[model samples]
Target: MTENQILQVLDKYAKDYNFPVLDNYNFDLAQCRLSVFRDDNEWIIVFEIVGVNPSLYISNDIYAYGNSVESQGLIIGLDDIVSLPNEEDLFDDEGNFLITPFHLDLIINSEPLIIKPTEGEYLELGIQTELFNPTKLIRYLSSKYKEKFWLEPLDLLNEINMSEDFKLFYQTDEWEHTDEEKPSENKFFQSLAKAIVLNDKNLIQFKKANTHWSNWTWSDFEKQEED
Candidate 1:
């Protein structure tokens, strides 16, 4: 249906069923919002509710199925049929989730490094390990490499984006019924995976030099002064 027609349906629902209509929203890129819109074929109206958290959000959709113009009266005969999720089902009880795509895309060494949470599933419930935290990765690299690491940032990016295991980990994090055992959480695996990919001769050299210097005591400085 057209936007005007959608608005009219919303207005009718508000008047007849006392349904609240929230059309305009200014998202902060750190919060989630519910969406109600017609399907691509205009045969169904879909209502999507997003459960938000600090790192991400979880979403579930309900449909008012049938053609709007059909005798089915899907849009006209609107009812407040709602199914609420249990408190445990919510991704973020504090409600600090982000639904929009992050604006942290980078072009490092001519390769694109994007931070996209795989759909809405991998973003929450510990499926996303620390390696998936793009900001943290950036901060760590910037401080450790003096901004020189961006020349080869794709190593870390690929580690995050190219892993089939990472995707499967999320896809199977929650299962309704299964004979196999659930996957155990691997908190350090993400960091280890990234380190395996990003470690190079330069980083090794830097680490060695830093470690050597870090071992110097005040007596070592005094010895140097005497020498």
Candidate 2:
């Protein structure tokens, strides 16, 4: 149907659904579909709208949009989406990357640094590592690994221009204050960075110590591990 026709149908449901709109005549739709069905032998018209948010009534729209909609079938699939080559500079004239580094954080939280009691080491600043502190989480997660750094993990954080917060997690047993062999500083950051950027992991691909692939997430070794 034409955009006007679809707009009319959404308008018809507008009052009943109270979809977030600037006015009575307007609604946002990036994409939409109209479905017709027989329910209890009566025809029902369904409007599926992929709405874009450009307003303050987002919370109302989020739950309200789906409230009046019902399902016939649901399908979700994933495929590699090809990104077109762009000659556009990724950085500004100031030499800073145009893209921003997004940090994932949560409400203040802490998790214990798993240490063997035999070592008798403790932090006076609370025995548990602050999981919310990126550096401590990095170190704590690193302590769980047994691999040695192929690329000095601490150095990797600096070389890649990671923030100062990440620079403190040393990839060594001494940092952990335990005799147990240190986990790979290299793999620890690699794994952590990989996890942090799982959606855009390729955005900062680096050839680290143990891995040969630049993608890091998928390789013969990684695939084998997953299998």
Candidate 3:
């Protein structure tokens, strides 16, 4: 939809429904008055509609020790909302909205990387023990070796034989260990996932990095193994 159309829909919703307050929401209606922000490099629509209250401020103009100011505000990120066309009557399905090829085309055109699982390699072993999915493992090693490449995780998993106990141990301890070690690459991917899911613009850096990694050479892939 056009930006104007999107704004109109939001305005209509504000008038029709009482805006519900979300807990721990960090949007600033004033700052987002009519603009979008990049949260991890992804583009996100943010704005102050009506209803919700903005955070409070305390100010004392010379005389009093402290005075408070109250204002009602709303901050909404694109991730927090969904858009749909308006339908007049349910029984009369004349202008009912339908998914269009354009939507699918857009997704296909964007072509985000797909995380794959290795064959024969247990899921527990790859993500748990290796702390990397197929794409992630390749990306990790590529950077270490200063090369560019892509591969399916399922294919890699199929090549390795992992014992049951080893798989179990990795599954139980990987997340806990990751929290303590805070691997930069894993953290970066996790943040990127959140940005994509939320449509947060802030994650653009990681997205670019991912795009660059998609074109690595075979020699680069070999270097990653050494790392």
* Model 3: ten consecutive residues of lowest lDDT: 58-67
Q: Across residues 110-209, which tens digit of lDDT does each residue of candidate 2 receive?
A: 2222223211221521223322222222222223331221223333223333332432211221111101212223233233233222322233222433
Tens digits of lDDT, candidate 3, 1-227? 23233333334333543222112132111111112223222222222221112221110000000011011122222221111234212112554323221121111112323333343333322222232222333223233322111112232122122111211101000111121122233444244334434555365332232223222222232234577
- Please report how far candidate 3 places residue 225 from its true position, in Å: 70
What global local distance difference test value does model 3 have? 0.24
Clashing pairs in 1: 53-96, 53-97
RMSD to the hidden true structure, all candidates? 25.6, 25.4, 24.4
Model 3, residue 21: what's the lDDT? 18
For residues 1-227, what per-residue lDDT tens digits would candidate 1 score against the true structure?
34344444434443453331111121001111211122233422222211111222211112122234332112221111111122222124665322233333444333444555343333432223332332222322232233332112223213223222211111111111111221112212222222223431122111111111112222321233367
Comparing 1 with 2 on TM-score, the higher-scoring candidate is: 1
